[model samples]
Target chain A: MIEICEVGPRDGLQNECKIVPTAQKVELINKLIEAGIRNIEAVSFVNPKVVPPMADAEEVLKSLPKRDDVRFGGLVLSRSGLERALKTNVDFLHVVTTTSDSFNLRNAKRTVDQAVGELSLVINEGTASGKGVAGVLGTAFGCPFEGEVPLENVLKVAEKFLEAGCTEITLADTTGMANPNQVQEVVNSFLDTFGKDLSLGLHFHNTRGLGLANVLAGYQAGVRRFDSSIAGLGGCPFAPKAVGNVCTEDMINMFHGMGIDTDTDLASILETAKWMETVMERPLDGMLLKAGIV
Target chain B: MIEICEVGPRDGLQNECKIVPTAQKVELINKLIEAGIRNIEAVSFVNPKVVPPMADAEEVLKSLPKRDDVRFGGLVLSRSGLERALKTNVDFLHVVTTTSDSFNLRNAKRTVDQAVGELSLVINEGTASGKGVAGVLGTAFGCPFEGEVPLENVLKVAEKFLEAGCTEITLADTTGMANPNQVQEVVNSFLDTFGKDLSLGLHFHNTRGLGLANVLAGYQAGVRRFDSSIAGLGGCPFAPKAVGNVCTEDMINMFHGMGIDTDTDLASILETAKWMETVMERPLDGMLLKAGIV
Candidate 1:
């Protein structure tokens, strides 16, 4: 069995040029919950001035279906964001930093070490505040400004998060640059080092059509949790003309078809993708929505 | 090393609502050849009334850049089509028949057995005239009209073709219904049955986003040749909203990135894909074109 954390509401919506209404975002979350997605990245607690799209993160969280089983999380960039997330009822907090120093400075406005230091406090304080903390290493595969990201750099950041009491660590292909071989190599190293102490998740972008193949590699590497978005939303701003995260429905269909237990209903996810299309009033980047589960 | 027979000219253009002029088709072929593709399915000899897009097969064949190293073939549906191909100076002839009775009857106006019998004549005539002959088993994975295609039925057709002097057989996923397991099973069976006598090629559609995965499966099962299209053009007419064949550039990038040698220039293919996009006046269904080589 695998756990898929629906990041459509957070990572997906963040990249959209058109701002979706708070109510529709809540409805999307409710629909995903109805489709058996209990683990969700519901919001990003970043400054509204920086990313106006996520300004309504608090309202979206408040309006979501209150279920004991459904665990919502907010992605945080700094200590303030983490403090803000601790005030909310969200069950978890995800602190993110890039592996490349150049990308770390450009994306987060902080050096890799500074961001890692900030995330360590986020992890320590959030855990003390009775909330599970997840450490996300973005650009772990490759960086847009800096071409290749060293695997050792990614591993060091992840080790810091693990040492700082992070419950889970997510290795993210922020630039859509990770291939199956590289994904397997990184995932295997993480499992070998921190598999006993920390749970691992993989976040991928479908920009190069290797997203699901990377997922298959991760599965083979004994990592079960993945991050996906409905309609493959969240276009990459750094990479011009890049597509979004892996389509949630397409991943589920492939996994279920492969005889792996995804436990997520594909039909329901398709319906939510349909709703997402309608709300966005545009065609989204997805395979299952276009192909209709053949 | 793997052999990629680009089918962009015949299969990719057959489904286009707009007819690509004969000169443009030849240009596409020339561009593909310049990118290191030696084997190309350059034309189709079906009746112009049935598929008007391929009406200029004779003209296109006449205008092709004749080279000894580059092998071009025409797809023939019936014995008359085969006769037409024989009239041309092409290197090979590919005769096709579907495994599913309903699809065969509807597409070719003949039952599976009747089409196979007719194609046997195609193979005999083409091989007798010193041209390499190939038999393509369409719907070898599954049929849209009929749910599942038995592996025995597909192999039976393949056996008839092999006995009829076909040196190559292509198992085509006509409706994009094949999963990786199915691809592995079918390729394994073909390798087991005609290990010494024949080479096998696998064709796929990207409708379910499993095209690359299927290719990976076929590779693991000991098959090396594959059929792909530039820009992922040519939608399936039977399967509603079905996408096109796997994009040739994307497949090459994947195989080459995974330490498999394709010997094709990635930059040159991307240039051809760009030219194709200009000719079609629309963006194509390819990932590498959007996200340039990382």
Candidate 2:
């Protein structure tokens, strides 16, 4: 079965208005469980006022039903957040850094050396606890502030994370500024360096409408795991007009059309996406949501 | 220097509701030329009644100034259209075919073999007279009617056209069904097969918004020549719901951002795009038109 990591709760809710109640977050999680999503990003333990959407992360985590098959994860920006996630009995923690030096400084409030140092700390902490850790290289494609990030910059971040014991690494087209050639070059470089030791995944936004194409590029470059939000729900709040993530249902449909077996029910996912749209009170970025699975 | 090919006259008008006046079409061509478009596809020679937008093809061709640097080409669908183009002083003719059987039948009303046969006649007649003949493979990336056009299918068409003495073959992501992987796979195949006997170009739509990404992929595969419409104008009249082509301005921005010069004026082309948008009475598909070149 093709790996589908549902990032709706973390990446999805982080961009929305009308902060979902903790119980409703639980309801969403329960629904995802019912839908058989094996890997779910439960919440981001960030400041409630900063991201009003995910303010109730602790309550949501507490309300989750412990299932055998599903793995729970959280998105964390710093060591303090990672520590919070470690205490919650989660399976994974996603630590993010920007590949572009300017973006890294602006987004993370640190230089490359500072961000790399923090990543090493988080990776070490997760490994010591016997939990999987993932490093997400934000702005892996291109940067709004910096523009056209060199491939070597992404490679450097990946090398630092891997050296610090990151078991999984995801390259993010954070601003939807990445094209497929850049995706191929970065992915191919990682593969050349780490091979099977690194579990490579992709995080894409449809800012310029390249979400699905970039994912396809990743798949072609031998990445088996992907992160997508239902209804293409989220954008970066800090990243200045960042677009939605790759639509989960559309990605599944494309995969299914290609005879690649992704263990996702497109019909059910589409229905969930409709629910998301109603909750967010916004139009979704997913094409299949409107066109249906053709 | 960016190579700006004005596809607005062909693609931008083809999708409009009102039939563009013959004089307006000529004015648009003149404006694009004034904006410094060295290569322009003047108009298409198809059934006038079927595509009323292109009904005044002969008049439009006649209206253009006889400039050595500015190329005038017509999109030809059949042998009759090529015959008509031959009668005119068109510098070149662009013949297209769909890689998928369904799209070929639906769009061109002929099977691939039959379309190739028709294309061969045009190539033979046009090239023998020292006028350039080019083939554009529609749905080279993916088909809206039939999803996932096989590489073998595109390769077969390219081989047929190359053997028939076509000067260039452009892989078109008609309906924006192309991804970077598909773009690279198809373009690499052409390079491996025909080498330098035929030049490879890419034409992509921004429907699913991989247009620029697909171009990047083609570039990585050693394809230097590319086809883009100004202000992202132009979708196939056959593909009723297809999105616009890759924006000429955006592609130029990408090239300039990457330190590659295409020898075209981006700011002036954008001004021309804005003027054309006013004439067309609609918003263009080009993002750079709204976002401006950063």
Candidate 3:
């Protein structure tokens, strides 16, 4: 069975122009959990001035339904975000840094090495507080500003994350510059370097419409975990020309259609995607939302 | 190198609510030629009343530039359409029939065997006139009305087409109901039966967002030719909930990004897709048009 992490609450809503209410965010999480999604990135503990939509991260986390089957994660980019998350009931902490210095500088206002150094402290603190820390390396495939980030840079960052006590590592195509061939190569390299026992996840953007194809490549290369957003929500505020995250319902539909068990209820998730469309008050990028389940 | 057949004019424009002027249709073909697309399904010779957008089929065929490097094709569903196409300067003829009786009945008002019987006569007539005949089996993957079309039915239709002097066979997922595993199975079966010399092509719809993924599977299974539409234009007017065909520029972008040669200039095709967006007077479904080349 493949695993999927729903990133709608945090990554999906963070870039929206309108701020989603803490209650609505909590409710969306409730709906996803109802759909049998166990792992969800529920909120981001960042500066409110930087991302106003995620200002109520603590409130949203506090209001979540307590379930042993569910895992709620919060994004932590720095010491401040980690501290804020530590005081909350978030089940996990997701620490992110890009492979390219240009992207890391723009996203975190620090170089790649500097951001790694800082996030290492954040990961250690979160782990010390008994939180499961997941390291997400953004622009692991390619960077918008730097064009092509070397695979070596990706490995270096992932090594640092492992050394800093990250329980999981997710490679993110931040601006959707990855193709299937690149995904296969990166996935194989990661598995070869870290061995098959390493917990590896893949996050993709649909900016260029390659999200699912990349997922298929990653799966074929023996990596199973993926990160997606409902109704294709969320683009990076720091990444120019970035679009929505890979649609959660659409990816689930692909998996179910392929006779692969995702242990997720597709019908329930599709209904939630439709509800998300109304809440966003706009048409999102999900194909299943428009075409329905085939 | 892979071959791409631009189907924007015939399959793409046929479903548009607005009637595109015959001159604009010719201009679109000219732009496609400028972008190095050699094979083009230029027009469909169906009843003008049934498909009003293709009312000027003869006029569109007559206005095309005569070039030795380009091969222009016309869609012919029946003996009447074949006769009409014979009167024009169309370089080749594309005869289509679905494997499922439910789809074939709705599309051409005939059963699968009846379509194969009548289209065999059309293929003979087109071949007699020295036109390259390509047999397109629509709903070869899955049908909107009939859930799953068996592989035996697909092979039966293809075998009939081959016996009728068809030079090529293109399997079409007319309603975007295909998965990657299914594509791999079908493509491998076809190639295994027909040998490497068989000219096999794939046509996919992006309704469920699996168009490119299916294309990847087809390619991995040894298919070298694909059909795509500019700006992802056109859906079956008869197929409920059907959306656009796979976008030409976006698919090309994927091929180019993977270091695979498509032999089509992406920048020029992107320019034409931008022009098509203005012609359609709405946002098209292509991702490259919105995100630009990565």
Worst 10 residues of 1 chain B by lDDT: B233-242
Question: Distance from true position, residue A277, model 3, in Å?
Answer: 1.2
Q: Estimate, for each residue in B226-264, the C-alpha lDDT of model 2 and write its tens digit.
A: 787877776433454656777787787677655688777
The most accurate candidate by lDDT is 3
CA displacement after TM-score superposition, residue A21 of candidate 2 (Å)? 5.6
lDDT (Cα, tens digit) per residue for candidate 2, span A193-287:
87855788898876654566677778877889999887787754444455568878877877765568887677777888777777666666665
The fraction of reference A/B contacts recovered in model 1 reads 0.48
> Model 3, range A90-131, lDDT digits (tens) per residue?
999999888999988777788999999999999888899999
For candidate 3, give the lDDT: 0.90
For residues B1-294, what per-residue lDDT tens digits would candidate 1 score against the true structure?
999999999899886656799899999999999999999999988888988889998899899987999999889888788778889998888888899999978887889999888888888888999999988999998998898889899999999998998888999999788877778788878778777446889999888887887887788788889999998878644545858898899888878777788878989999999999898777788899888887
> Which residue runs does candidate 3 get wrong by more than 4 Å?
A235-242, B235-240
lDDT for residue A42 in candidate 3, whole number 0-100: 90
Maximum-TM-score candidate: 3
Ranking by DockQ: 3, 1, 2
Q: Put down candidate 3 lDDT per residue, B1-294, tens digits, no spaces.
A: 899999999899987666789999999999999999999999999888888888898998888888999999999999999989999989889999999999888878889999999999999989999999999999998998989999999998999999999999999998889999999999989988888899999999999999999899899989999999998988543555658889999899989989999888999999999998898887777889879998
Ranking by TM-score: 3, 1, 2
